[model samples]
Target: MSFGLEVMVRSALSHIGDLIAVSLGISLSLNNLLTFYADRPRAILAAHKKFMLARVAELSLLAAFALLYQQYDSLYINTIIDTAAAQFDAGVPLHWQAQVAACLIALAALIKCAQLPFHGWLIQVVESPTPVSSLLHAGVINLGGYLLLLFTPVVAQSSIAIWLLLLVAGLSTLASALIMTTRISVKVRLAWSTCAQMGLMLLEFALGLYELVLLHLLAHSFYKAYSFLNSGNAVNDAIRLRLSSAAKTSFQQAQTSNTVVPNAQTWLMAFSISLAVVIAIRSLFGFDGAFSAWWLFALALTVLIVQWRTCEHSPSIIYTIIMGGFLCVIYAALKQAMHYVLPSYSTLTVQAFSLADIWAMILFSLLFVLSAFLHYQVRWRAVRRLSIALFAGLYLDEWLTRLVLKFWPVTLPARTKQQHHAKSTHQPSLKP
Candidate 1:
């Protein structure tokens, strides 16, 4: 390679810079070409070989990039590359310098994941089956958080840079999330959740507390995946949607011999497990007094399980609305609690990963095993639900945050409806 070509290629291939341009280009092209050749579903399934082969080509280029870019050569290749290294390497104590480099490297990897060109290949990706969307959302696109988590050890050491990255990403993601409308399939929403969560993870990196972020990522991923997969094609779950809980109760009353299908023992077990989780989380955080969020979460989960088991026996419309409402409430309450109590922190490797913290890896392994087992059931509709839901949750979270910041300007008097109500309530007190 000529010096200029070598410099350009090497800069593009940095550990942090990795294989984005090529992978994105390939993903975009195959996605577009296959879509043109076939209808949405057929193209997705039939073109898997081609799509995967394209991914292989991209990844192979990345591997080559990794090998070639190991030189750290100072041809002053690109301003962006130099700036990133300088920022990562600057003013840190020598002992912690490597740690900072590691974090910058991690940050670069994450940006690559979330920072694709927004040219709209995402739309086609969602048109595949619900399960695929959910898997892509909660599993693949979602990898950014874990990548950030993996590098938290090095990132936490860099005080100013990490915070700046967090703020910029949060603002950008919040803005982008708001612009995304309901025109896209539900899977896009899940993908956006990956964007939003990755932003939050960046914030955690900046904040220097990786444990909570790690915990959050792990828990978040599985639950999100499960939910997206389950809820993706709920439009077609016939018997469950028609009957309401009240109707079921009435039926039980009318027909004494009703089998009650759920196997009460299983219900009881689930409830106990749910309750224990509530108490454990509450104890860990001391939020809402002792058992506050626990009560809300438990109640919602209970209703959800009951609704799920009885959904086949009920009406789709009622079941869906009720289930959706409960889920929203659950999500809102959890976010609120986290905002109030948790200090966002990064889990930099030196901080989060010790020889002792090998346990996290072990725990992750177990989670993977459990996920495999759960996925063995593999209903197409279920996967679709999980995918769409994760994205929607992410999109909604970012959108609402943006809306408040933009219109309400919480610092201003009339920024929020709650603030307006507060002022109104105090006006009477002041007058009296």
Candidate 2:
């Protein structure tokens, strides 16, 4: 329904349906919040409160777009485009007010999508019922990307808006992906992973890969839905798999060796293999397009292929190569199909990787390498401290919870003294 509304808004050049669609999107988010309220899990009440506040911010920013519509005296989004085009023709930049409106809209998208700083709410939304979590993660929250895609003409005109989306979304992707690895609980990890994936989706929109965004949006929706529905069975399945593997290994000598951590030399080899594969694909598939989306996809595939070779229980080289080739071919084919099937409502323009973008990618690469090193190497004091911080989500959410509570006190359900006493008395002894 949201997608249908978005399609209508995009197709209707003169209707005020954009505002209506955005309003409906917000309503859906509010519904999710209301569902959370009904369940009201005591453990996550504070998190739910923060989530509500973030939604309020999101709602406000989305509502603010109405001001722009009124200012132009036309309910049509074409007004924004025609005005900007006129300004561009006249060798004039967009008005400051227009830029401000664009930034506000982008910020709203960031909040809706649960990017960093505002990200605490999203990671903590695990308190919601699994169905709500599935709906929020899979369906509702994705409207942010749609919003950006819908308003690309106005939003992309402002350099401030562009940089804001890029930095915030990119950093959020990096931070959330890193933080997700340190989490232990299955649901919490899934929540963090959602945050990371949202960040990545937003980042892709900022890069003007709308087709890729659509593909990701569809794929993630199905995957997240299945994951959340089957979440309860995850532990059971893991245990069963472990037992089965143990049974199979009992008759043979067990290999209980420590995992071999890939050293610098191994990393170099992997890098070389990845590069060669990328070059081979480019040469064979005539993917020598602009140094943009294809290159990134190739690099990602290269990394996966390397991991397939090095990771525990690694697949055979022949199988890995075949899988990599299949993935590359399928992705390229799908991207090409989407190019024809999905029409763009606005001109897609993202400046090729700026220094900031490059630096961010480099930083993420370094963090990933260090994390892998720490995971396998002897746990030094520094590694331990880093791991602790990551495990605690860098205390980022905790701090946000504190600040939010300071301003908006959440009234948690009061526990009886007897309940507290019972909890205290029931603390399990560690003695074996």
Candidate 3:
């Protein structure tokens, strides 16, 4: 917040941009060099050498950053804010400790721009299949979010930071969506969309209230992950490209039509339902304030499912049982992890083996066994049913269990028995 420090921080941020630009330049230069000399059979030796050198460049930078943080005790580059965060706020002499935050912010920004070692072989990626490109450059990568999250304290405090993130997310989204229209390659469009979505999430984290940020991130990540995993769009595009390439005499280009009706009713219904759900959830949860609701998550999931193009039909009873069993596996993993990390939470036992805990455990142990038996549980109907059930459970935890229990306490059979015994003994004494 101090004048000089702010200037220095901005300088550091600019440095990050500069680093990204430099990395981009180097990457493109390597591309051209590879194109010209990389193709020669004899260049295979040189290719290996160049690859090794690029790897070295990446590793060296990473190590230097690590060493700088380690040897310099005054340098505080740790994730958790130390004096540097404060000093970064103060214009104090770049205490060896404080300069690191700026450096880290810079580092994270640059690392984000490059998309890192995964896409290090620039020529190879530029020549990759569409699906691969989408997954690599656009869809699957999550480092940007991680980086932003890592430095949220620094970034979130400033309006410019929020605006920058919004610009990135918004512009990327628009560019990708627009480009998708012109792109013959579906996967490429998907990649662009992913980048845009990621930017949106980063923007939301920067601009929105802090509470909404993580949930937004969670939802966006999963939705994007789902789309990236089963992207038939790219495959479809590949087929179209192949068809176009095939002999013209043997086949005719398929006629396209704009007859597909824009389903306004469905969109309206979905939006209404989603909004209703958020309001209902908040109300049911008995949120501290009235009318405070958020449904970014549900919408994201719904979008992903809709895009996956699924249909529903009744699942066999056996299949449902099998799916329940899968939930058991998930529950088991969750419990094990929770137990390992949070031993004190075991106090969450539901009142000395009440129907709640008993049923929960039985359900946990049984559901997955059943699901395993009914392992062919791929139908959307089954998935929908399971999802609805899960949502019901979440509602119970978030709303009913908390709010309802506070007002209406449960009466255990043991308590009832004890009361009866006490009354019986008093009656005998009174008669005497």
Cα-based lDDT for every prediction: 0.45, 0.66, 0.39
**Which residue runs of candidate 1 sit more than 4 Å off their true CA positions?**
1-107, 115-124, 159-161, 176-185, 237-432
Write the residue-wise lDDT of candidate 2 on 1-432 in tens digits.
134434545575345465556556655555555445443444345455556665665566545556666556666665655565556556676667678878888887887777777777666666666787787778877877766766666776778887787788887877787788788777788778887888777766666666777778788889888888789898898778667967557424335655655667756655665556656665676532223455556556655666666765888766766677777678767765655544443343454455544644564565556556556663678777777777777776677667777877767655555556767899643311
Model 2 TM-score is 0.82
Best by TM-score: 2
How far residue 161's Cα lies from its native spot in candidate 2, in Å, is 0.8
- Give the winner by TM-score: 1 or 3: 3
Query: What TM-score do all the candidates reach, one by one?
Result: 0.39, 0.82, 0.39
lDDT of 1 by residue, 1-432 (tens): 124323434555434454355446545644554444343333343244334434543454344234324433332224334433344456433234343454444445444344322213333455555665555555555444544443333344555445445455545344334334322535565655555555545544444434435555656678668767876456555356446687687677758864344556745654565455555544554433112223435644644555465544654545544554455455545554444333232123223343322332333333333333233333557644543553354343344334434643422112345445667787432110
| Deviation from native of the Cα of residue 215 in model 3, angstroms | 7.3
Cα lDDT of model 2 overall?
Answer: 0.66
RMSD of each: 18.8, 4.6, 28.4
Candidate 1 lands at a TM-score of 0.39
Model 3, stretches more than 4 Å misplaced? 1-73, 83-125, 129-135, 138-141, 208-267, 282-432
Worst 10 residues of 1 by lDDT: 115-124
